[model samples]
Target chain A: MNQVIETLLQHRSIRRFTDQSLDREQVETIVKSAQAASTSSFIQAYSIIGVTDQEKKDKLAELAGNQAYVAANGHFFVFCADLHRHKIVGDLESADVEDSIESTEKFMVALIDAALAAQNSAIAAESMGLGICYIGGIRNDLEAVKEVLKTPEHVIPLFGMAVGYPDQETDLKPRLPLEHIYMENEYQQDQSLFKKQLQDYNKTTSEYYEERTGGKRADTWTGQMAKMLGRKSRLYMKEFVENQKLNKK
Target chain B: MNQVIETLLQHRSIRRFTDQSLDREQVETIVKSAQAASTSSFIQAYSIIGVTDQEKKDKLAELAGNQAYVAANGHFFVFCADLHRHKIVGDLESADVEDSIESTEKFMVALIDAALAAQNSAIAAESMGLGICYIGGIRNDLEAVKEVLKTPEHVIPLFGMAVGYPDQETDLKPRLPLEHIYMENEYQQDQSLFKKQLQDYNKTTSEYYEERTGGKRADTWTGQMAKMLGRKSRLYMKEFVENQKLNKK
Candidate 1:
């Protein structure tokens, strides 16, 4: 396998990081690489905030489910789906950007653009010998995050990422088999074979967690998902998105 | 800058690819790298369909808004926001996976997961001297793509990617200014400054396109967005997503 392919295949989220600060040049390079990712329609409706202040990090850590690793990471970036820039474009051109910006499709473009750019940033950081973890817990308190970050209307925080040198090595988490996902020319409804493959993967995941977490065997993929569903993790997201002036076409 | 960073920074969407086939080992490597991407709660709610069959490619090209490049590209992968695996898991465990799988939150997770994995694949492919272009037009006829790809319910085609050696060298596409995106902590809403910067970028983009396309003169960023917004894109995404059993309790 190619080196890049090998590196990607062996990727594991690093929650623990060494106390090493990334150089400014390195950060700039990663951000530049991020900016280079393809944006839908070239709108580039995304922004990233680099969080360096320890106090603010502490506050953000609290907001994000008390993830200590977020506080200790060398660099933290909050990725936002931003339509504020287009609003500026409208202001300059004296054109009504409101008609276009207030639709669900526009909001989705921004969200997907943010995700694509962040994924590029992650890949760029990994290539530079940095370990990274995404903090979806940022959505835990969307309102508080908005206030803390002072996000303007039309800009919503989608997620956070922690980047730094790895403190420990980890195993690659296994995934479902390709057959479970790779379809031919139509949507297939074959469930029996897919179930068998997933059962084997569940066993693999359960055993891995058991060995790694030192007997703290978390639920299999199915059980964890069941628990997650009941958690209503994104209950606030809809209202938050609506409040941000999205989905208001 | 690191070599990988340089490569990433210099990335351009190469829609026109040479008539070369990717080896099986190369395909395996790219897919493995994709599998290594981060998944929300490790549910890994995404998958890719690799299309090498010529007839299938022709049909896909037609379905994806008649993009001839797709049929001629070396490799085409359709990324899907998939929850079907979890449904199968639920059935085996006799768990209420339907409840878990049927939510906007789950849909978002699946979409993000699919996008992140696809980004990884793109980066890995780029590092290996291949070029890629994302085909967002796949959503033009989402139902047709689902049917053509044999996608089961709960698996929406998010986007398609065409990859191969570049048949032509394209210049890098310009993005909005860094200040427009890389905010400090809060979103900066200085409309005047943003407009000035974007106007400058518009000029830069115009120049870049002029040079790259030999005076085929694409519209400025704002103009393009205005034209795009005027069009009726994503016509059936809402109903399609609903039909996939998402966004429901």
Candidate 2:
């Protein structure tokens, strides 16, 4: 009902952006807003890299599935699920924390921490009248991202975000109904209810694609998900996380 | 600069709550605002379980490292990183999606999706003059949670949230300096810069604890991290992820 809630509820991902650049103060405030988000145990296990150089942005754009918005946006940031700082903190305290930091739970902590901060950044940017899109496509090639960003081990680039003045507005994408997404205190194994919800949702999605893509591609939600999930996507992410030496004792 | 950004920047985790309960309409509005957050590829791989029953809340409180707030908050929600709906969606389309749904990337997608939604929910709660605290302590024992919540396979209880009108106001926890957390174009392997920033921050944190605890406990950020990360915490999380049949081909 308030402006903040209104800003959040009217959210949309913007991929295309005008050529206007974000001032330093705006980016600083945005990152500050991100820092204010909740972090597990106050660990604050995340880092963000602002990519402004055109050459580097081009390389990053290519690495992230050629998302031109990575370079074209007013600002681009790669949010890193980082524990390397903890390592330094341990070293400063003369404690060996490599094994403890490498646990899968710790890794999940960092990953979730990065995501919470990013969502705050996204909302903050939007509140400032900026358009933004998340580029999970960065995972399309993690090795290149590591190299391009010189990201050290114990630090993984989870995703990138592009922010700028809007070049276009997009129709809000439909989501699964609230009943389907919100359960009671216990998980409801309602196969019939779930099936019924998706059938109607798929119909809405089919029309959404038909309208958006000019009938070139009109498929149900299940149809699209099946096509996507039928084959292996991002199969290398396990190896990527493993290579970070996170899943070790 | 704006009210929304100001609200975000001033956020603090509220663990103590007054004996106030959220109205049904408020809960409905909060969940609706959560549903408005961005999802990856429209999968919306997340679910919110509202827990208002005191018995279940007490059990969840015990399970989540005895965080009394889990039971005392105005409203509690267990945010699940769920792919179970996608499974139903698959069955509706009669598409084999097990392999695709179980990949590490998809798992991360779900995890990030849940966090984004939870953050939105937190902001929405705050905008309505509510208070919130995230309970990652839920991961302290996921099996108990799954049993309590009847969570099925492919659905992980990612985290919980306690929302209420604040019973107590706590100081905002300090974060690492922007220079330490933000890099330009590439990851900065500047150990010297990180050390400098952390030393100052550690001093600030030590004073904060000293002041907060009436001089009973005075520890630096590095000191806390060293003590916490010196041993394996949540050692069973790897097996938990493994048990979900994710992160495998």
Candidate 3:
């Protein structure tokens, strides 16, 4: 395998970082690489806000479910699904953008754009021998996050990312078998087959957690899913989307 | 810069593909790299359906706005934002997953997860000296796409990707200036600054289209935006989401 594929397959989410800061040029290259990702119709409906201020980082870390890595990383960036730039482009040209910007399809496009770019950034950071983690906890307090980042309407803070030298090593987490996630021509509703696979995966995951947490958190993947998806959390996302006026009729 | 960064920076969408098919090992390696991508809370809310059947590919190409590449590529994979597997997991455990699976946050998570994995897959394919392109036109007819793939409810067909050897070469598309896409700390409403930069970019883009299309299509970025975003298109996405019973209250 080539270096790129090796780097990709060896990926691990690093939550702790070393004290050394990233060089400005390294951060710039990361952003440049992110900008190179593909976009729908080349609209480029996303933006990255790098957070270097200690105070802001601390507040952000607190708002993002108290993730210390957000504050401790050599660099942090909040990727925003933005249509504000499109609005500006439309305004400058006196073109009608209201219909498109408010449509659900446009919203999905922006989300996909931000995500593709973020993945590119992650890969680029890893290629440079930097550890990185994506912070989805930013959605825990969307309103507070908006205020913290001073993000305006037509934009939503999709996710935050922390990049730096690794302070701790982590094992590559196991995933479901290829057959479970891949299908041939049509979707398969093999309930028995999948349930059997899940039971096995659950046992493997239980052992992983047992070893990782020193027997403190020993639960199967199903157990973890029950705890997380048992009840609705982050329900405020609907309100946030409504507040953005993106729910086109 | 390294080969990885150079490959990322040189990314170009390849629509025309040679008749060379991918080896079985190469396809498996690409999927393995995709599974290595980080998932939100480790939910792994995604699935890939590799469509190598010509009859199925032709149907999908027709559904995806008749994009010839969809049928002509050496391989095609429909990356689905899937929650069906989670729902099945919940069913097996008898967990209260109804609320969570139907929420907007969960929907966003699945979409982001699928996009991240798709990007990793794209990068891995490129590393193997293969070309790929994302097909957002999948959304143009989601119901037909769902039927084509036999995808179940709680699983949305987010996007499709075509991968293969390059039959035609294309230039690296230009993007806006760094200052326009990258902000520091807070959101910037620099309308005047961005407008000036966009005007310059539009000129470059106009020339690109003029030279590439043999003067058949010559327009600025703003001109393209006006034509695309000036009217409401793909509004059925909301209906599609609702049809999946994901419109949580």
Calculate DockQ per candidate and list them.
0.54, 0.80, 0.78
Alpha-carbon RMSD, each predicted model: 2.2, 1.4, 1.4
Docking class for candidate 3: medium
What lDDT tens digits, residue by residue, belong to model 1 across residues B1-249? Answer: 666676678788998988998887777667877888888878788888888778888988888779988899878888888888777666666666675577656766787788888888888889889999988878778777776787778888888889988899787777777766787666675767767777887887888778877899855777666566556466456666778897543
Worst 10 residues of 2 chain B by lDDT: B240-249
| DockQ, computed on Cα atoms, for candidate 3 | 0.78
**What ranges in model 2 sit over 4 Å off?**
A213-217
lDDT of 2 by residue, B1-249 (tens): 799998999899999999899999888888888888888877888999999779999999998888999999899999988898888767777888998788888988888999999999999999889999999988989989988899888898989999999999789887888888999989987879778888999888988889999999889888899988986689888788779876554
Regions more than 4 Å wrong, model 3: A214-216, B214-217
Q: Which of candidates 1 and 2 is the stronger one according to lDDT? A: 2
lDDT of 2 at B84: 84
Q: What DockQ would you assign to candidate 1?
A: 0.54
Fraction of true interface contacts that also occur in model 2: 0.86
lDDT of 3 at B249: 44
Cα lDDT tens digits, model 2, A4-52, are 9899988999989999999999899889989999999899999999999
